[model samples]
Target: MSRSVSSHTSPVVRVDDLRVVFPTMDGDVHAVNGLSFEVPAGGALGIVGESGSGKSVTSLALMGLHRGSRARISGAIEVAGQNV
Candidate 1:
């Protein structure tokens, strides 16, 4: 969505400063950092990345599937003005 879009018709999906980290005994693996984007109602959003590039991790975060995982996720994900 464009930045000029007014607040009255806000985005249907929003992600801000999304970061996913896995703390292994070896070290911390940063999957994503400072990712932000928005998709307006009826709009489409695409995510593309190479293998092991955090695409699946990001999706897992969006779907609330990492609740019990050892990974640490920080940031905001909103759908229809509500946090996910």
Candidate 2:
């Protein structure tokens, strides 16, 4: 996919290299692996993925909804033009 500059100002949410990892009994399971996307204000976005594709996890991360302290996250997550 091509990353194009939005015609407007900064997007409402800008996710770059967003990674979400969960710790399992076996080892650390990588949910979101270096996934990057941008959602401009008033723009609609859809994420298509099978089970365990990190679709829900990515949204949870963006909405600050994650369980346990064992979840390890890296990279950048910006919401409302502010990095979280």
Candidate 3:
């Protein structure tokens, strides 16, 4: 589960300042804010949070599977060393 930072060929995924916002009847829900992390090639990473913590949304974002097109996402998201 551990990997040498310099040994990995490239980051399997890279998220920087990643944010996701949703507009609702009340206003806006900040699902994610300034989230940042990297999973290097052949490496393991874990995300832990309470319900509605944006955990699934963040992973889906990495897979390019966010539900709404209206969702506002800022910052950078890279997968397999490529921007998405």
**1 or 3, which is superior by TM-score?**
1
Ranking by lDDT, best first?
1, 2, 3
Estimate, for each residue in 1-84, the C-alpha lDDT of model 3 and write its tens digit. 754566537778889999998878899888999999888876789899999888998887777777567677888998887899
Better of 2 and 3 by TM-score: 2
Candidate with maximal TM-score: 1
Best by lDDT: 1
Predicted candidate 1: what Cα RMSD to the true structure? Answer: 3.7
Enumerate clash totals for all models, in the order shown: 0, 0, 0
Flag clash pairs in model 1. Answer: none
Better of 2 and 3 by lDDT: 2
Error of 1 at 69 (Å): 0.6
lDDT scores for all predictions? 0.91, 0.84, 0.84
Evaluate residue 45 in candidate 2 and report its C-alpha lDDT on the 0 to 100 scale: 85
lDDT at 53 for candidate 1? Answer: 87
Model 1 Cα lDDT, one tens digit per residue, 1-84? 554545568899999999999999999999988899999876788899899988999989999999999999999999889999
For all predicted structures, in order, the TM-scores are 0.88, 0.83, 0.82
